[model samples]
Target: MKEMQTFLKKYHEEMNWEISNESYEKTRASLLNNYMLLTTEVAEVAEELRKAFNFTHSHILNGMKDSEAFDLAKENAKEDLGKEFADCLAYMIKFANYFEIDLEESFYKKMDEVKNRKNRDVSLSRK
Candidate 1:
């Protein structure tokens, strides 16, 4: 992913697309779409909360209901958010391709940088 970002950055510089790199544009688009999905998730959670706490004035009860709402939120994450997540990845790859990225060379260079890095420990920590 980082390799792709780097390539996109280079492409943008070479093409002089100064507002944003292609990769960042894709990411921003993904984030915007993801935000829409998040709002829906919030709405779902709020509806669940209303159902679970329509009679509850107790703080503890409300908290538990909210927890249950979040459990439902987790389900929403797996379903709707998951779809958006996949779409984001696809868009990123498409962006890379659109910029005529040589992913193989980019990936190899990234690997080389990783291997040669002084902060080898930090690279290991990434995964």
Candidate 2:
């Protein structure tokens, strides 16, 4: 998707100062020992999802919900989750780029297959 590419371009430019091949390699060595593999991308996505969930539910960590803490959590969750989801998307886009995959076409194809499977299952069940 062009939108994904656009977002990725912006994100890459914004993060250029902080991200580099050496840093990536170090992270890869620590977490995966490989760069830009599907398994590594999946793991990064899962970690980002966990981070977003943690930020959204951080009020629970206080043992009891303080009104102030709950409000702060609510306020921060939106921004934090946005950042985390962006990170997830970045990894997915990177994975697609590394494999030279067209995500938009693949997405539609998979959706069509799923729809066909659902329709076939429903028709059979009515027999």
Candidate 3:
């Protein structure tokens, strides 16, 4: 993950896509714009899921088994889903790079914190 982040940092620099830090206003605008783009990519990920679900439903209606239809739909959507996820990751890495944040370290630290935290939701069980 760290290596990927480093690679993206250099890639973005080479592509001249890094967030601006020229002035406070410029930095603010750049951050907001990038955040919006990230959200758009996220929506594209959701769109891919919707497409897969619709495709699976169509196949099922045509008499295909549920699992087989879903599997085929999932496979068909995999490439576009991956591309959307990559787009999201690129924007996230860009923000992390701009802030000098070590995303790999932060991710592990956060996961550990969540792991150690007490669960809040109560389990429902039938007697």
Candidate 4:
């Protein structure tokens, strides 16, 4: 996760240099814009989901008889899903960076909270 944070920070720096005269903190106000970008990215993910499920409208309307073709489609779908998910992650890192939040630390903290909740649930269930 640290590696991802470092990579995202470097990528954000490069983008800032290419695109803006303002500081990154100044960019925080533009988070609504980032949210819009994330929305579009999520749509792309939905498209990838269609591919992953091999459920295009044409595929649904016209039946498939070939298993080998579907195997290939599945592989391509997996690759597309990976790319879309990475795109989502990039934006999420940007969101975190905008607020100077440490995603790695926050992830661990949140997971610990989730784990404790699960443990509490288990204890209650046993009693």
Leading candidate by lDDT: 3
Give the clash count for each candidate.
0, 0, 0, 0
Task: Count clashing pairs, candidate 3.
Answer: 0
The residue ranges of model 3 lying beyond 4 angstroms of the native Cα positions read: 120-127
RMSD to the hidden true structure, all candidates:
11.5, 8.4, 2.5, 5.7
Worst 10 residues of 3 by lDDT: 114-123
lDDT of 4 by residue, 29-72 (tens): 47767778878889998997776555544454476645655665
lDDT of 2 by residue, 44-106 (tens): 656655664575466567564666665665565567556656655666666565456788888
lDDT of 1 at 108: 92
Quote each prediction's TM-score.
Answer: 0.33, 0.44, 0.92, 0.66
Number of the top candidate by TM-score? 3
What local lDDT does model 4 show for residue 88? Answer: 85
> lDDT per residue, candidate 3, 1-127, as tens digits?
8898899989988998889989999999999999999999999999999999999999999999999999999999999999999999999999998999999899999989977879845659877
Give every collision pair in model 4. none
What are the lDDT scores of the predictions, listed in order?
0.57, 0.60, 0.95, 0.72
Look at candidate 1 and give me any clashing residue pairs. none
What 10-residue stretch in candidate 1 is worst by lDDT?
51-60
